[model samples]
Target: MVRRRLGDAGPGGRGAGRSGGGYDEAQAQAGAVLRGERKPTNPLTAGQVHVAFKCHNGKHIKAESNEELRASSSVIKEPEKFEVEHSGSESIYLKSHTGKYLTVDKNGDVHASGVSASDGSVFQVLLQENGLVALRSHCGFVAAEANGRIRANRSLIGSWELFQVKDRSRRSRTEHPGHELPEPDEQDDAPAFFDAFCQVEGILTAEERYAKTHHDRTAVLFDKRVRSRRRDHMEWSFKHFYMEKEYPPSFRGCVSAWDITRVEMDADGESDTPKAEDTEDAVRPRTRSGSDGSQVVSFDGLEAGRCHWKKILQEDLTDAVRIIAAFGVPAASAADADEAAWQRLLAAQAGCKQKTAHVLVMCSSGLCKAIGPIGVDCSPWPPALDAVFAERFAGLGAGSIRLKFGALPGEAYDVDKDPVFLAWKRAAGPTARGEDWVLQHADSRLAEFEAARSDYERRRLSEQVSTAKKQLEMAREHGLPVILQLPAQDDAERCMAELLVAVFGEASQHPILLSGFNGRPKCAAAFLRSFPGMMVGFNGLLTHSKHKQSLGEVAFDVPLDRFVLESLGPQYPPADSAAGSARGSYSHPAHVLLVAEELARVKQRLPRDILRAAFSNTAKLFNLSI
Candidate 1:
């Protein structure tokens, strides 16, 4: 059973007389503190506040996933933060960042394991004259050991019992009546609430904030590998993404294993199905020789679109061993490298003297690869066959895989509309090795679509319309959210609305993400009308002066909860120049912060509030642990 640390001054204290009958006076003193009749010498007050504890030895106390409390980590990650809630008088409840409350076990070991405040969850704060505090339990005073574990079996106060608490109340998400001003000596990771937003302050402020706090932050990579190994090993790593342009070491986020499908237009500007070689059947032949010597074609419905699954699986298994070898984790065979296995590896890694834990995987999208393959090339196959394949894949993932539907932007055009793309298509003839041509006309491609305004309006709307309908149908059938990136065309909205209504019924609650929205305000509201749970995504376009007012209008009209922030990465840098950002200056992860600050300026809300809400919305959509 869980235990709390209420000592002689608790409810039991009302009856137990000790220390020359000071119980009544102690009770009265605690009451005074709770009622604001008296202030404790320490900074803590009656209300709840976010806080971090620094031990006498100067190490910060961190909450481990295993529930044990330890004072070992020097850097303050999310787990290190705690919410201190006033229970009564001098008694308080400490909750970990993950929502678990600190509890004392029967054996006196303190763990952040309480689901809710109950018997071993409460503790009385003993504010000391030295501006430090100690917690007392019925068993003994709480203490931090030099070995990094926390326990409450100490009978008397000692150096290990005292902890210097710093108020991090500004970061709290609870509804406090008021917040105390931060100390002047407190580190300014970004502009304080007092500072107003300005153009000059956006990116620079974000860069400074990233340098100070997020240097060790976890980042999500989409089918990309880290460029270089850090001095400290990562929790995980995999070979993923573009061979030359990989993520920087400072990149912090989650990892995704992505099966890629490139959308290409024919010379006459028609959507072409991916070549047979790009299909799953082409990569791994479906026919197998039976014992009777006849050829048999396997009809496994679950393996649709996943032509490269075996290859991916083999590489991932090999990479698991590579990570273990590189990080000096306990040896393990490739056979034991699933999610739980990876967690065990990390647990062992954390047990060592390493400063950081890294878990790397080379994939696009998020965890669990049972979703098979994802793409828009199910054509030439029967509708019934496609549906069965999609359903089987969806069932295997069990909601782990999300449907990502990317629509053409407003300026999107057929290759026939651009001489360069058209010429490239003619020369390449829908081949796989045409990326060089794409690189050559990168800037002019989107611009030329605007030049063929009439053609773009008609073609872009119909471009992926059929495939989108099919994807949405699959998503609706499986109750999976669709991360839909809409084209910039206004008709694209109408087209999507019609498709959504047709697929999921009118005004369905199907979760959808409208990513990189560069469209009109009317279209956004109309699209929202069709799917209420849809969220609009704003990318680096938020930082552009030309798109400022229009996007800002959309931001204003839409409910604040229905918006999310994104960065186009290096593709859409703040610099207006189409070329030459100079070597080593193309990194743009910090630009996400600039997007947040700009959105805050448009909404006239606190940057932190906007950032917090945006992050929460994203986490909810992605089902990520924040």
Candidate 2:
């Protein structure tokens, strides 16, 4: 029910009229110039004269021997002249001295052909500030030259569309009162190409050419100003520069968190001491003097290994200040280095003047690697370590002890293929307690297996169901908060649901943490609904991609309690000393500092109770307390 505007120009002037039926403002201005109502401000005289259209590439549009116009670099002494006559419409027709009108054929080629005005012969002239003009044909093709040949085919106005219209009638300038021509300077005649071209053939110097090529003057000036300010800020003396020692000097007197698992091997070539299980009364603390005169404390019962904590403390920390010493123990091991490390840490905690520092011992089933492939090796923790630490730490009189257990593959029920299942099977043997436990929970699946169609399929399904039940029982025995490292795959949602069902029977609201999920909304949302207290860990590298404008600019609509920043070490490239040599190699100090700064900025928007940062062994080597 709407009427179309007759004067509206279609895109690219597809169906526009030659005069004014559907001409835009630019075309209307061109019409006025062509009709002589408005004279061009350029010095070019309006009269019949031999004119040459020069392109930025030093080529001139000239009529060939066959009367076809082509762009040529070769200079010609005399060219055919044409009469500039207005067509009384939105364009002008060029009449050659030989009396043929300049027209375009069906192929968009320029040549003097028809004796009368036609749509193909009509051209709208656009004037530029640099005394250059562009001719657009009625069919919306701008006259342009490519590879030294003139063609009416370009659809956009660019460097190639510009042409230098020179008046060839310089000898008759005195006869025309208003057309006073000035002497031409070589530099003034240079065309503004402003892009890379055949520079060797051009007359401009490198500096002059660069100025024209970089047309954005404001950007260039701003960059120079920034560099100048940066130079002023970098005026530092020799005292400001210091080499990085093995440990920062400032940390010598300050209370610092140390991961004993990262301590280097002693001069005696022993990486770990003899297993603590071999000796009775292992809870007694023993001290030995190192070659550097520092006292090394070792504990057998708590599995805390040798630590140099005493040498590093100038004065005991205040009662309110606590230094955390954290390490993890695997489930299958009767003796583990992390266990010895924790015992040593706790023994040291008992001797301190103030009960300020504490020890955090993480115990996990030897299934860390079975969950999925990760950049770093996932150390396994013995299930016994969880029970032992949970029972022992309850009565510690010194600094408190925090116990954490790693959850076995919550839903990795592929019995034959899953490492956790295979390990449990081997440990339990044919007549072990695990076999009885598996049968008790997998009765329904075992009944189905007895009536399955294929023997191979039945065996696989039966083993998987058995493994699922065994894993569920393992989760129940811990009776503590568990960390669930989910597989890094798109189907994590289904895996999570299956794991929850296997562990809790239905969906008991037990506190669980899910790791290894990329910060995708759908994956996060799936965990949010099913597990109310579920903590989802995302790779810290996601911050780089999500907020490109600045560091710490990322925001998520998900609750803070459900979000966790994890895998800080693997995100950084290895130190230059071991570049490309290992996956999850040690991180450089600068890399850790950069991540710490970013996390500090991002933490402002997160909830106070949110579990802020998680680190790998390599990242743990860096000072994370800052």
Candidate 3:
């Protein structure tokens, strides 16, 4: 049986009586003293707040406000875990201020929200959304916890300069200059709220998806390897958009495994019927990602981990190593050299003294290949190079120097004992790659903001239509339907009502591709309202961790299978730029496989199905779960 042990305290001191004298009785006595039974003292060192009088009858009273008493506890509580319901536009403002855990109903004080009081304070939870869990300290996310910070991940903490490449020689031919890529063009007229963002993100994600589907073969072959080995050692290096996601410059998030599920439906291959016409096969149940390498597949059900992997790295290597070890996993290597370097790293971690605990150097096949070939004990990677480099530095009586490597691969192989290097050894997980991680959410007056944008869009669209119809000498196309397709995975429905306006749509008719917020000054809602009675939109799904993929992403409670169907309606897809035959399209396994593998590894290390559920809730609130 699973051992359910309470951590010292329970609600109102309910469980403590099991040990020794009743802790409840002691607390009642303490409460009496707190109430005013005993004599008052100056103050007791509880935490920060002062405790005054010690009354008789065991009541230990503290003269703090009733509010403080209501919230007081020895442990710190997280506010994000608190679930509030959104009945509608009317209910978002109606969140209960009582913050009570139970409601008086036919169920007899059943769970009001998912949150339950624990240890007088702390709230152990499963996430219900993706935004910052605003706390007294600052804003942060639970995903940051894996990186040695139990606290929240700070919002947009770093400046652009922090990402400057240190060495020019080590740069990849594809992205050596590290120049800025042009943000997608935004129309002067844009929509409001997430509507505009959805349009913009939809275009971008569609473009990227096109690259994957069309250019995948080319991207796989001649995939320029990002990191290289110099002479007898490894050279850890990278540049923007280098060979792949695992290269230090990757925009991927900090993902964990077990966050994606892989299913197998009946329609993966052609039917056995030899004479069947229109021989289209049925769709199969698979993981979120479609890889050329079929052997490394997993059927677990994690879907929202894509949000985690694409998250930035907060902690450095040393702390990262500690976190890996905490989960009983070994250190991940950049290349084969990491295997031998593991011993040196272990010794160094122990101050170069006799090593106590043994650590295994695990690396993915993608990463191993990056460091070139490997023998029984020799290679030219960071870990292997570090061992030699450390020795060289020590021999020269130089000061201690830290060896840094770029993004580490997501795979691992135990270079020590029983030889372990199987397919997807540590792969098979969900990931959140390709999305912005920082954005200041407009708070406090969100409702007002929504109202303002809607009004603005209405007036603007009315004028545009009035003027356009006069100029073209065309009659107002009354009762015409307008379609604004959000990215494929994005919920265009919520923002649909907001963007229904007649304008020069795609094909000059039918469904129009309303240019969403492509870094444009105008908002999406206002742009839509400018053209009153008209249906205009194109379909394209902005694929990413849904949260930071702009407002174009939609949310659904169902898995990827069901969520994808909504995008198939009348919508304009992104133009594929990487389309062609599968010849020169093939790239080396460098950035291509490395990225997928890294994404896979990162995905494999996270919590799966639960994360997706939380992601859905967030989508609903953001108006993306249409």
Candidate 4:
């Protein structure tokens, strides 16, 4: 019943909605431009254009290094660009800037790993009345999750599934001519490198010629801006001083160190591609492989001649400490000295929470005399306290801290006045440890419930109180220091903290430590206010590429005396770091040092100073002798 037009040939036509069209109209126009046959003056509106998909939430669809397509909320000005290659009137293939095609998996996950456009990569573009578009794969509609993940799993279209197609070619066509725009692979051409280098070279004086030479060798930029614009080094005034010729933002914070061994890169060639055997200890440039057999390079934060403080470059602090302990080997065999560093880091992370009848603290002695010890176990839960609390205070009061826990038949006790409760209270007092008692949470279940506080919230609270009471009893019985090991999540553990304050009274000092804190800036201030005498623990999690920027912000406010180091297991390790061959051969207790060094790197302090302060805090907390 449909009338046919010159261009309107249904699904098989080039421009189904317009007159005078061909399926290869877009391809022909692109080819003509590449062949220097014509100018792309308003080419985007004429046919298929390179575009970027911006979700309603303002995030842009990006291709991760693993080729997984996700919605990224990064603050960078540029998002990943994709070219629209039309298959039919309604179907198209989204080709990434790297030449790979976006394909949908059997599970409906989108990935930019396909080399050529195939049936899996063909997506039907459904235009909506609101000017947005929905991409339909074989399985379902492509959806953008609130967490910045992209998938094609939903059968129905929703707000999350709709994306605003941004014409990247539109801006380029009008403002920048085709020849004027640099090719993607030529972003870091010689002219750009020289421009950046000359700016640094102009600031150097005759006396600083050595620094100038060093800068020339190591100061290479793979991209225009720093890898992480928010990196601590980027914020350093010295960086601004050298690059922008400006004074530091503050004079008091401007401390400098020379004779530091920087992370060395082989300056043999202009290529910035990373070597095959780059070790974890090296601060070399990072590289990603492109689908077209080219490499894209980036620097994580190592820019030379910025006057960085002494970093633990050759060996992690723990490895260096261990090497010094082995009677000090010559520089030749030093590489073999700290072979077990990786194992130690693994052990420290895996055994972070050691369940034992007693808590023990060990101290290390060597060249780095204060390199803190491993195997500091928090006291385990006692069976007796559970029995006692169930018998005395479980079900007597309504919000009474009694009825919520549900006690046995006809059981009640004045918890404040009870002999057992009073005894535990005495043992929990600051005077028991000759300094201050700590109350740590050992339960992992509370964090799950913290996300959703249901009818069982009161029950969980009562249970936490009983555990704290029991832990105090055990610490008192064995003459152990009661350090409050709180969960990294503040909301769930905040209740436990408030309960302790309510029961024990905030007047008594209880030193607290967040065991697995991942250096979230929002959670840092809240933790400081909620727990008295609180200390933040720096762990391996903070060393991740994603958390690199946040770590500096979190570490800036923490007092040197109030921060401790932990080798907590990494929640997400990179693909290479997780390989069985790369397991224990990598960072060890040095993992703790790496965290400290990162803190120090951000705070602009010497690595040794950070290590000493952390070790001192550790010793004071556990009441251990140096």
Candidate 5:
């Protein structure tokens, strides 16, 4: 019902909202495209626009090849901070100083420099991640998707990150090309991939969310699930918890403190669009797809600060009503025709003691305007329903918060498309062992491992893996149950061919739990024969795409105490590491179970404690607590 007259209709074309004129396919595509050629979304940067632009003189330089001269010419203005031809500019943050970078708190990775800074500087990349192989494939699902036009404007929205891993005082080695390997002492942190994934499969998005211009492993957008009713409506959901009563005016200003719950994209068109694999349908530009798409293409902290970051991006407003029903709500827009109906919609939630989850739905166009630098509403919840909060079940506790949109086929939010496979590929492109010279290929690498059911593989160097076990023994000497990060299946499988017990000699008497890429035929049985009951029965399936961006990988196969918080959150202390955070103290399953047991005695009346005990028991029994 609103208007956004800005650019064209076609991909990479122009215009913003529909001009009251009818829809045209060609205009949509052309309008979607930007003024010139666009950059292909790539991994590495933490989602700061990573562009290598040419100056007005039409001269372009390769920062990678010519470091010195490239540093001089790279001092261009930040596009996000660009000014009009004659407009006054503001001097902020050292005028885009060199060596300045965006470091995603989630991971300790450091991308090179921004296009505005010198070539050697470090900066976050500002590009959409939907189509990229590495970023998209990292997690078990796609957390962010593009929006806008079928042609160009497709973008993303999330925390932009930047950092460099060069020798920085604390470490003696360089950062790139095998200089900094995993430390033998630290382990226990899971890779900071995406935190939690969207459960919806096959929903369409007018707007998509990105992690960073690149990848940050805080959480996965989804696990894997087939759709029972994916045909009904394509949609996604994300939740962000804000401090009750007081929050910064906008997230842009306080983004560093906020935890992004989940980002998922419904690649389909409208919610009602039939689920089909036609990639052409997904080709629409992100902006035109609606605010969801726009945010995906262009991540914004400033805009989210200005407005309250509330949006509903479904093309047909009715989609909101249908999707909210999952939470037992029903209403569309704050209209006058149905006051009673509105109350029914707002009051229709179950009264469960578990914390209520808050969700925001956006129609494509609505979300676009919400983030635009123009006029729009900027509140957490719609003003019209201000009176409805006191009595609603979903609004009871301020714990869970999320944003979602209708999805289309190939929507990253869709559960039908394998989340693990899709996310892993996006985050760590071609992780398959041998495809087109890529370190990992999708076919042989992924499928072969998935077939293995989650087993560990040891590549001949038992010294490193064996040393990790020794550390576990050291921790056990201290009465701490150790967490051993079994290497991704391949790393463990290499040792199978060895005839000498000298390699895995530690397993000669004590067997460890069989996990990670365990689908290798009889892999667990072989270990049982060698070690006898030494193996724990936990499903330790980890994707090959993992580990590269996660601390979990570095800690894998090593004792948990060896894990360190080198990256972002979801970090746990290795069983033997010096305790700093509560999470670190309770990193291992044995410690967690012990803590829960202690709580069971102290917190005798709390109902959730029983649940906690159940969880603790299972986690310790399987060694899959992470």
Candidate 6:
């Protein structure tokens, strides 16, 4: 038994430690203030207070005379001012200037009623970092605004639970009590601004913390700052290059390199015909009449550095009947004039009306020519060499374009000297046909590359599937979501298909996400056909020229469950283009930041459910502590 001291009840009535004592004292003070028996001891000089809450839909909490609190967007001419009386401890009792006290009911509805500081009328004032205050009812629910009404409902503190309390009586700076203002600092404010920006953009919530967690095991390692830098660089690049055309919808899924020369040619060809003098410094052609009344032009280079002759010959000569190409010209006195003459000759050939023209473009690699159809004939070279050339010329035109393969009379196919050629030949096999190269050999080589990539994916998925299956088998496994990330390749699909077949019946019942196969619609469709229930996603940046053939077919063809914009690490090769290389390599930090910024923008544009589910799945996979 504890003895009560006289000081415990002196003046204040009961001990401060007692539970009901604070409420009784607060109630007496509130009653005194309401009855004009005592002056309110609140620090804030209030006549009319404007309370703004940080709800999903930003609106102000307003109180009408003798009515419940509600959120409103309209401006109140005469707002109700509360006589804020300080209660014992960190609590307060707000009495409306109209002789009514703000009280909460059993249902959490707040209304202006009697002046007695009952448990409903007493509120704990919680201060937040953003200079906002939270009002918590004695019933352990935070006073929050939801759907245009003020109610005490939230158990955890969040942006929605906070309110900005301002004293209207001291609205003007001159009339307000003097106080020292904090010094302005740009560096300190940047993080706050960034956090607010991220919150508003839905990339992060107010309660979410940013931690430097490694995401290497995921599709790509994303850095928020790097993403911002990438966005800035792209915008600058677009403006600097004066590129005005909108991105073709087909190109959006894959990372690609654009030929500035081809873009210039298209632009020029669309508006005006390029003149002979326009290309006088680039190419020179000496023409002679053929036996069949056709023109045969032998193109020569005067200067080595005058133009990218290889690019022009490779890209522009697709429509030509045959190409005789050569490289490495000996230093000559009249190199500039000779190059100018060569450009004039090529320009003449470009404007020529002859259909069966045989053009020779010389380079360092000696003279090479294409015979037969205007499109590339892959029959000359090995299947592997043809595949390489096809990738190089992918951006040139439409249809099944093949590269001219095999060696001419002077040139021998040197598989011993070139390691790349040797590897290609080994992969293509002897039976591989060059005529159906793009369909057969190229696809086969792509399959081989996929196989190599999938080896690791297969191992990883095998372990993950085994683990997930075991976890599902464990007791109380309900609501536990599992996500498996597989490389966007056929082997991955094959491996997944095999593994999933065993657990197909069990997997269909649980929440499981299948990521990294969204780049190809056919692949995604295949997975969906097999599983019919698994959620699928893709890494948007992984699809390159090797996958370009199927890119257009998948563009807007199938609806994706998720779209993940992943960052190819700093060492990832730039897209195959002169302009892309000139832009310089991306740093690791810049890569991550750019990816994060892009992810945010993508989130804003994509469907809400897909993004939400993707993020949830990612968090589950990475166990992100943030």
Clash count of each predicted structure: 28, 19, 105, 11, 190, 26
Judged by lDDT, which candidate is best? 1
Q: RMSD (Cα, Å) of candidate 3?
A: 32.2
lDDT of each: 0.47, 0.37, 0.21, 0.42, 0.23, 0.35
Q: Is candidate 3 or candidate 4 better by TM-score?
A: 4
What is the per-residue lDDT of model 1 for residues 1-626, given as tens digits with 9 covering 90 to 100? Answer: 00111111232222233465333444355456556565456555535388888775445689998888998754455777889888778888899988999999878999888889986888888887546789887668888886678899898998889887866666433434476554323224332111010111122122222332233322212101121221112101123321122222212232122222211122342322223343322322243222122232322211222232223223452211111111111111111123433342333223333433322222221232111111121122112223423433322110111111011222234443343444456677766455676676655644433333323233322334554564465555544556555546544455556666777777677667676677666566666655677787776676677876567666765677887765534345543211112222232333455567667756657677876677566656555443
Task: Tell me the tens digit of each residue's lDDT in model 6 across 1-626.
Answer: 00112112233222234564343344464456556565433333233342223332323455665477665532222343455776756677777645677888887778877667777898887754434567788655554443467778678886557665534333544554596444323222111000000001111110111112233422132234323323443211212111222211111111111111111122122212223342333334333322122233323211111222334334331121112221111111011112333332233233233222222222222222110000001112223223644444322110001012111112222222222344455699997554453444555544433332233233332334343233233211223333344444444445445544555442353434453333344455444444444454333232345543343233223233433323222233223211113223221111222233223332323333333444443333222322
Model 5, residue 354: distance off in Å is 41
- Residues 278-363, candidate 3: write the lDDT tens digits: 11131111222211112222121111112222111122333111111100001111111122333322222232134233211112
**What TM-score quantifies how close candidate 2 is to the native fold?**
0.26
Off by over 4 Å in 6: 1-102, 111-119, 127-132, 143-150, 153-160, 170-393, 396-626
- For each candidate, give its TM-score against the true structure: 0.36, 0.26, 0.16, 0.27, 0.18, 0.23
lDDT, residue 285, model 4:
42
Ranking by lDDT: 1, 4, 2, 6, 5, 3
- Name the weakest run of 10 consecutive residues (lDDT summed) in model 6: 192-201
TM-score of 5: 0.18
Residue 205's lDDT in candidate 1: 24
User: Among all windows of ten consecutive residues in candidate 3, which has the lowest summed lDDT?
Assistant: 397-406
Runs in model 1 deviating more than 4 A are 1-259, 262-463, 575-588
| Cα lDDT of model 5 by residue, 450-549, tens digit | 2221111111121233333332333233222222223334323333313114333434432232322222323332433344323222211111122211
Worst 10 residues of 4 by lDDT: 189-198
